[model samples]
Target chain A: MDFNIFLETSISIAIAACISCMIKICTVTLNMKSKLDSDYFILKNKLILAKKENSILVNKVVLCNEINSKLLQSFFEVVKQLLSLQKFIFEKGQ
Target chain B: MKKKLLSFAFLFLTSFCFSQDHSKIIDSLKTVIFKKPSDSIKIKAYGDLCWYYRTESIDSAFKYGNLALKLSKETSNQVGEAQAYNDIGILHYNLADYKKALKYYDASLKIRSVLKDTMGIAALYSKIGLIHQNTFKLDSAIFYATKALKIYEEKNHTRYIAYIKSNIANIYRGLKQYQKALETHLEIADVNKSINDNLGLTRTYNNIANAYLFLKDTVQSEAYYLKSIDLALKYNYKKELAGLYNNYGGILHDMKKYLEAIDYNTKSLKLREELKDSYGITSTSLHLAGLYLDLGDFNKARNYLYEGLNLSKSFNINELKMDAYDKLASYYAFKRIPDSVLYYRQLFKSINDTIYNSRITKEIAEVQEKYNSAEREKEIQTQRAEIAEKELKLNRKNTQIIGLVTLALLLFLLGYLLYNQQKLRNKQLQKESELRQALVEIETHNKLQEQRLRISRDLHDNIGAQLTFIISSIENLQYGFKITNNKLKGKLTDISAFTKETINELRDTIWAMNKNEITLEDLQARISNFIDKANISASNSNFRFNMDEALSKELVFTSVRGMNIYRIIQEAVNNAIKYADASNIEIHIKKKYEAVVFTISDNGIGFDINEIEAGNGLSNMKKRANDMDATIIYKSQIRKGTKIILSV
Candidate 1:
């Protein structure tokens, strides 16, 4: 009878140990899932911020390109006027 | 009368020098300019000389072109200055100095546009496109080529139109747009033939052959190649002929006619050598190496490959050197030399890394150039507008919104996918852990049941039988007293003595069974006992097994883990006996480098390690070593038994 009790106790202990291990695994998995969700949210927020920044940069580049074109055009026009005057004088002299 | 005769002589000589040809005209003009030291005539003479030598000698052409530029600057002749810049740009382009060529081309374009020289601008655009094509910027090449084509078409310049068409075709070929390339080449070829332009026709034929080759139409490719070759030979263009031979060799090499390929490549190599063409030699050597490799002559292949690699390296030709490294790696792999294969693979990787970086640089340069050119065009148009009204505001606004929208969409998708993947992974891990726990529980329960059954059977078979025999003996003793016989009494006494001895043996068995739980100390004691037995057995030879004194008595040993360690030691000992056949053995166990290390060494007649097969026992040892995440090394030499070292 004592041996039977011993066997029953050992079986019960083994089952309890398995149940505890499974609970630990489930808890760990749940913790990991929460951490992953948090990380995802952080990354998503960062991506949105980066997108906003990129849009601003693109706007700035476009504005700069436009201003640069205008300046170069005015500069070229002045130079062209000077060149025409010189050509006119040279042709009139010839 | 003598003075008049001398004057006539001088006048005739001067007129002859001026009227002979452009080169003679340039020479006489140079002398005149040297005497007078005037800028206008000198610039004209330098410009003419630059045009004359443009195709023949790039250095001299550039030199004279620069001289013209300087003279034009002194005379304030913008037209002459622009022409000189264009000539210098062409010379640089011919020399493959694209960066410098682009600078000169841009300078000439600026001057030409200022002077309203539309033809000059168109020509400069063509030259820029040619530079882009040579640098493998196919899209930019096509853009400029098309711009030049439009201008030439508007001016009704048929010859210039044909040239632009050919340039566009070359760009298309570079882009692998075979159908477009072929159509353009055919149109250009017809125009050139109609105009009786043999030089242009030969180039067109070569372009056609390249397009057909890209289309994999070998017959058409060969036909056009032969036509180009014939024209090249007839015109005595050694450079073009060399290129033709190399192209033909590549085709034959692709066709698997190695001998013919080698023959053609050798011809090409000879021509290039005569021409002092280092780049051509690098390419031809690579083709020859391919031929040798295809013929299965690895030694010859390696010889050519290494030669090509050295030449390419010396010339700083990264592309050809990369090819050579790839071929060498393959050859070493085919030869089954693992070390050589690994070395050449590393070389191949380094070369590829360099090529990737260079490609990225090339891409960035191309984009920059396109952006700059577009900006220049915009600047030109904006000069005509009085008020700088912002036309790009709407475009910028639209682009910003589009960029933001796309980025938002991409980010959302990425986050969604990542979330889903994480959830899936967690589910899988949970399931795996659950399964593992179930297996462990089932195995432990089954083992316990088997142990109990075996114990029950042992008690029933041994002790039950012994007790039954004692009961029968007592029953017979009672009968013996009833009989009252001296002999029967003596027999009963013997039976009692035998029964007492059996009872004592049963008690001892029970005690041994109760002592079966092993402790750490008990494990160490058992190992020591085995070592002592081994020492006595190996008395003829010197043997030592030592454990570190620093080992703690509190060190726990699970039976299963302990059995594995014992088995590993046993296998090592058996291997030493069978393979090492050593006269001396030393075994040591200690902690080192954060690991427990077990070492066994012997000095005996060792066999060639390379000849030993990794049999089942060795495989098992390796697998167990892996299970423990341990490293095992067996080192031996001839006439030296072996040393097996394990770190866990």
Candidate 2:
């Protein structure tokens, strides 16, 4: 009877040890998975913000270019008008 | 002499009437048109009046030109129409509106081309070339000038030829080809002298001197310049004298004679001031600034540059303003004022970019305009040729129609033949489209039939054979049950058990097929249960199974992939059970980045890993892994149990 009890105790201990080892491994794997998910969310947020910033910068650059072109066109028009006026006055004097 | 008298009379009637009361002349011409209303007289009156008011009153010129165009069109008179368009173009040219000028010039050229008026066309070319030259289109200027020269030479119009040569020479001067410019000017001078054209002679000598100056031939340039100045004084040409002084100041400035440059520039400035010439004043101020800068008087230089900059800006002369900004930048840099230097540099760059971009825009527009005009000419030529062909064809058709009308009784017989020909053409087109659609439909039907046959073959060859074998085994088991021998009973029992197992496997296959839509959570739970059962059956080994809880519960696998994974795990466990005398086995299921991973390990007496060949079971495991696009690895040693890792 004592031997039977000893074998049962050994089996129970082995089962307990196996269960404990499995629980420990599962816990470690779960922890690693959660950490990877958290990292993925962080990188996704950074990429989204970067994309938004890049778009805004591109819009500003486009607006600046438009303003520059308009200003140049106005300057050219003014120059053409003045040159015409000068030529007209010079011809009248001649 | 009569032609000369008529030319003078026309010039007098136009110029003197404008000098008198312009409105009265317009009223008188309108009254005459209202009374007589003759198309030829109306066109002549409008043309004469347009030339009179072209410079001083552009609107009145446009009105008269339009009236002349209307009258000329009413009479279908090409000469009158060309004259009206040319007058309108001259008015626009005087207004410095080159775009409007080009439009009228094109219209005039079109009418003249229709009339085959070579002289009128050549005159229009010269006018257009002058406009292009004034707008700084040197290449176009050269092109039109050459065209006009060729036409004048052909007509033996020597005076007009001299004028074209002088225009060409001026273009060469503007382009900075000084040697070519001098040669042309010399030719003009010789021609003018031969004709005793005193005004032309004066202009030619001035142009030659300008060319020599550009070539840096100081002695000849100075001599010619003096002669030009003397002639202007003799002619009392105040405007010409001012220009001569300005050119002389520019030359003196280039020679580094600062005081002489200042003196000549002052004289030019005084004359320009008297004349109220803002452009000339601006030029003299710029020259004075350069002299001050050379004399090391920074304050005076700044004052003069500022003055020039204001005048140039107010006049809207960007080129002069750009020059002033360049000078200002240098002055500020020399003054050692960093901020002022930077500001002026920025101003310089802005003006420079504006000028360059504007010039490029203008050039591109001009090139496109030229291309369009050339295309239009080509189109007109094609149209003319087509019209000529059509006219010839129409004349032939008219004659044929007249002959057919004369023989009206023959017309009914040709109609049936024409109808039959058209019917044949329609049939040919219909047949072509019908054949095309039939070929496409046939190909699609053949492909569909091939797919159906492949599916039917797979069903009959695989599942049908397996069912037939099971049926035969079952019949044999039933027959053996009737035999009472102990050995036969054992054999029959083994056969019965084997058939039952095969039935169960077939049922499992059906269940797996039905569970195609199972979620990953359910699959994981089933796998865990399977591992638990395996652990219970496994002797002398403690089994452990682990999984990641953080894996998404909604994850799913396709039936084919799920079945592959299950088979691979089953094979691995069987190998462990057969070969590994392990005391412990661990099965791990976890998520690895984007993949699902399964690892099975046992601590046992391992075999020589490298020497072991893949047996049937191992190969089956590899095949199952391959079906799922999964990777499998087996690690073993002589004394260590094997480990199998699978990733999908």
Candidate 3:
């Protein structure tokens, strides 16, 4: 009879421990899941902002490339006019 | 005349032998009975005392038998209960209470039969046979005795077989089947010898002696009676001896040895009185009364007659009572008293007639009982059939109702299913529309992002080509002209260098933009490339990058985190070379628990953390660490090395 009680107590204690572990694991999983969910939203927002910044940088680079190309075109024209003037100076000097 | 008394108290002989051997067994049994706490032991002890006192004390015997029987029933010891019933039956048999004896024997037989105690059942059969024999039911006696003998024979129970045969012989002798009686007694004697049962032999010898004396074989009768008497005396079987003496007296009276017969009869009477056997005493009393009447001893005749008559009346020994009455009528007639003779004669006839009438009434009552029970059985069977028919009708109605309910349930279920299906379909259609709209939105976003990447790649290609073409044109102009103009060459070199720097910056931006995720290996390769360039600029300084093998090569980070860590490393390295003027700089990456640790150390003129000014390099590193959810700590002294530890 004493052995029976001990066996019953041991079995109940094991079951309680197992259930408590399950509860604890469920609680931990919920906590981690919520934390990860919030992190995902925050990261998602950051990704949108970075994508906008990337688009702005892309636009700026494209505009700068166009402006630089025009500037180069103007410099080439000035260089052509300078070369003609240099020829004129030589002809006058001669 | 044949001595019609059964005298078959073989069971009592065996029980009394044990009891007589230990005269104080009753007292000891009583003492032990009171001492023991267990009901079973007490029950057994009480049963023992009950049988022990069967011939010793009538009231004590019944008291113990009742105690044993009640305790056995209370304890539910069926074997003990059957034994107690048998013991009580024997007590009744000894008291000449045949009805009560048969009742107890029937009770014992029922229990023993249920228990399947073969020996006990057979013993009850034999005992019941004795009761039937004593009651002049010779056919029933023969039937029961044969049943007992068959069982004993099947079991190879020789001693019990002898006991049963002795009963059968007595039964046969009473029925006056003398030839059959003599044969059965001879078989009983042989069975007794084979089993070596002395008490059985004593009873068998007496039976044989009676059979011989009745057959007119006085020589054989006298010889067999002496044989029985010899064994009875030798074994100290006082019960068997009393019976033997009674039979021996009857034989001697048949031989006209009246004086010798009286002596044996008186001895038998004294022994029966000592044994407290009411039947035996009454039988001997009547026999002695006849012997005295024969001897013309009227005083003794009258005394013995009254003694036997009173005892037979009290014990309900009707046959013996009638014998007493008949002998009393003879006595009165011999005394020349016609009034007394007539009175006793009437008494004798009435008792005889009552015995006959009671037998007839009992048989009629039994037949009536059997017929009434048969009618009751038939009536019960009819009622059961009616109940079954009603149940069948009710079941049919119940089944129809159940079928209707099931049909209604099925119809309701079918309707509910259609309603639920319609609801589910509408909800599904709505969800599908929303999913399709979301897919279209996501596809549009993907297309825009892809366009942006394509445009960025095209811009980088254009700008990179332009910068390279301009650098090459300036180099060609300087070399082809062989220009010794130092100012113009210096200006051209500066323009080329600036354009090269822009190209490198563009490449770095594109590298960071294209990747969604970066690993430590990727960062390490980028950092090593920057360090190589720094080494070329500062050849006197030593640069080291160390990564522990313990750190997993698969360590990954989001693009933002990767860009932040790379920028932090670059800013730290540049600050060390330009400001700290470090001779040796080490970039070490290692694993710490679950986190990765990066240590950028410079063995240069270190500045104290508290005294150092808050610069863009240090603040940028702190901001990057905070962005990545990492902690940064700067350890430095004025003269010691400066270390920046970042844990992620």
Candidate 4:
């Protein structure tokens, strides 16, 4: 009986807390909407600035990939030329 | 004594017309209406004229009021239009045209509601209440008066609350709830006093006196009547004075004071005529006739009875007309004229029966009005409940959407972190493999270089000495001997030159076999040495190399893998010089997310990756990168430049 009473009280407190949180979340969320459009997750200026930084990072990645590939291609050409040169030298020496 | 009473009565009754001549005001207002300064001003001036001529000339009042209504509508001044309609309703109400009065009041009410003019709405409701009161629709009267009182109370329009409450008190009196009427009137009296509204208090006093009269407290009734009369006379409220005098005369008539009743009724009738209070005039005329009959003056009685009947017929006052017929029957019966009495009695019965039927019809209407009002109240409650339910549901929906969105956001963040972690682990593995491969290459190169060094030493210490001796003997034979074949000498010279060239070639082969394990510092030094060589060869070009601060200088790698990296770097630098016409070149190695990233870039004319990637240009590089478990990405555009990133 004591356990039952305690459980009931605990359940009531939990329900009360849920209701309070719902109300507070609504208030905070609505306050956020008052400043920003619904589609966005952040302030206009902050989102724009974040996007700008992301764009720069993307450009850097693209440029890096291009440079790396160009470098690797040059190295492969040198290796191909060296192998061909070695085959000629071995054949001619024999 | 008669002259004194008449003079005093005249003085008090002289209020509306005597305060100022209404004709002069009407004429001036007429001129103002013609000279249209502003339509709103003209509408107001016309409304004033309507009020001024309401009691004086009913026809002129309606004409000017309609003009005001027309002008207000034309200018789209809804407030002025509402006021005009209210004035017109009052004019109709004064003439006892209840149907027209109610219609105009409804029109004004619609406008006031649209405008959200609560004060104007309350006033129209009070006026409608008065119309219902006059028409004897007591239920509707109380309903409208209560509605008006509630609005007035809500708005804290205290003075107007007393007015509506006074009207409600009168409705209670009509309902024969005399005690309730008396209580309401008493409260209203106090409210009027607090506001210093002497005229409003007088109306309350009159209602209280009537309630007392109905409750059989004649002394109390007379006392309240006198109190009301004193205030009415002081304020010269002619309509209120008229009502008070008639009611006081009723008390006097009951007390058998025929002469005093005649005096009060005379004053009431005179004032009623002045105010054009049609119902008041009809009632007072009948009462005065009854008074004259009580005085045993047949001539005066007959004359007043005829006057009352004519006015009642003209105004369609059927209830008072019946009373007039009854009184005529009594007058004829007192004259001992059987035929006249019979005629009047028939008239009375017919009119009374007609009134009874009309009263039944009116009662049906009143009941329907009450039922409709209740149904309207019920419908409003249902709508209110529905609206509240909708709002609660909407709020819950918003809460749920927010909850789901937050949950989704948390899930997405978790997913992103897991993916990033997997990527980091993969990069780490690839970097380790790349370094391990470099270690393998460096070890293999070292072993091969050791074999080459041993072979070269063997050639230099043993076979080179034998070759040197052979060469010297051949030289001695060619120099000491006198005669020799030219072909044989040339062959010997060819052998010496070939031996010397073979040794030089061996030295070159030994030079190509070099390092064992490579460190980060060694790689940097090697790259710098290569760049220095390139700069000397391609003097106009510049090269730069950068290493991450977090990368250790002593980080070691295998010979073959280091050799591969070195060869790739050399190949890339050579290509940049040979093909790219680039002015500057840069190589950057950094630790990113626990993975080592190598970026090779140049400010040169770039190539299209779409045109480049489809070719077999990167096949060997890709194969080497796959062996090391390293990933390489190449990006380039024409004139933008080329960049390559290797992550391991």
Top-lDDT candidate index: 3
Candidate 3 chain A, run of 10 with poorest lDDT = A58-67
Clashing residue pairs in candidate 1 are: B604-B641
Query: How displaced is residue B463 in candidate 4, in Å?
Result: 3.7
Q: Which stretches of candidate 3 lie over 4 Å from their true place?
A: A1-94, B1-20, B24-43, B66-82, B102-118, B137-155, B168-178, B212-222, B388-648
Instruction: Indicate the worst ten consecutive residues by lDDT in candidate 2 chain B.
Output: B409-418
Listed in order, each prediction's TM-score against the native is 0.43, 0.40, 0.50, 0.50
- Kindly list the per-residue Cα lDDT of model 4 for residues B1-648, writing each as its tens digit: 644544443334333434566777667556554544466667777788788888787888898899889999999999999999999999988888889999999999999999999989999999999998977788789889988888999989999988887888788788878899899899989989999988888988898888888999999999999999999999778889999999999999998988998999999999998887888999999999999998999999999999999999998888888899899999999999999999989998998888888788877886899799999999999999999999987876676565656555655655565565556556655655555555555555555544544554554445445555655665786688853556555655655555544433323222222344567787788778778877997998888989988998877655445544655566566667877778998988888886677777887888887776543335655655665677878778898877877776
Error of 4 at B412 (Å): 13
For residues B29-136, what per-residue lDDT tens digits would candidate 2 score against the true structure?
A: 665555554467668888877865553365777898898888898899889988998998877675556788899899999999998898999999999999999888
The global C-alpha lDDT for each of the candidates, from Candidate 1 onward, is 0.70, 0.72, 0.79, 0.75
Candidate achieving higher DockQ, 2 or 4:
4
**Taking chain A of candidate 2, what TM-score results?**
0.55
Model 2 regions more than 4 Å off: A1-94, B1-120, B174-176, B266-285, B295-311, B314-316, B331-338, B358-648
lDDT score at residue B619, model 3, on the 0-100 scale: 92
TM-score, structure 3 vs. true: 0.50
Q: Which ten residues in a row have the lowest lDDT in candidate 1 chain B?
A: B508-517
After TM-score superposition, the amount by which residue B196's alpha carbon in candidate 2 deviates from its true location, in angstroms, is 1.8
In model 4, the runs with Cα more than 4 Å from the true position are: A1-94, B1-19, B27-37, B110-122, B136-165, B177-212, B215-238, B263-267, B292-303, B328-462, B465-648
Query: What digit string (tens of lDDT, one per residue) describes model 1 on residues B299-383?
Result: 8888889889998888777778888888887788778888888887888888798778779877788678878888987887776
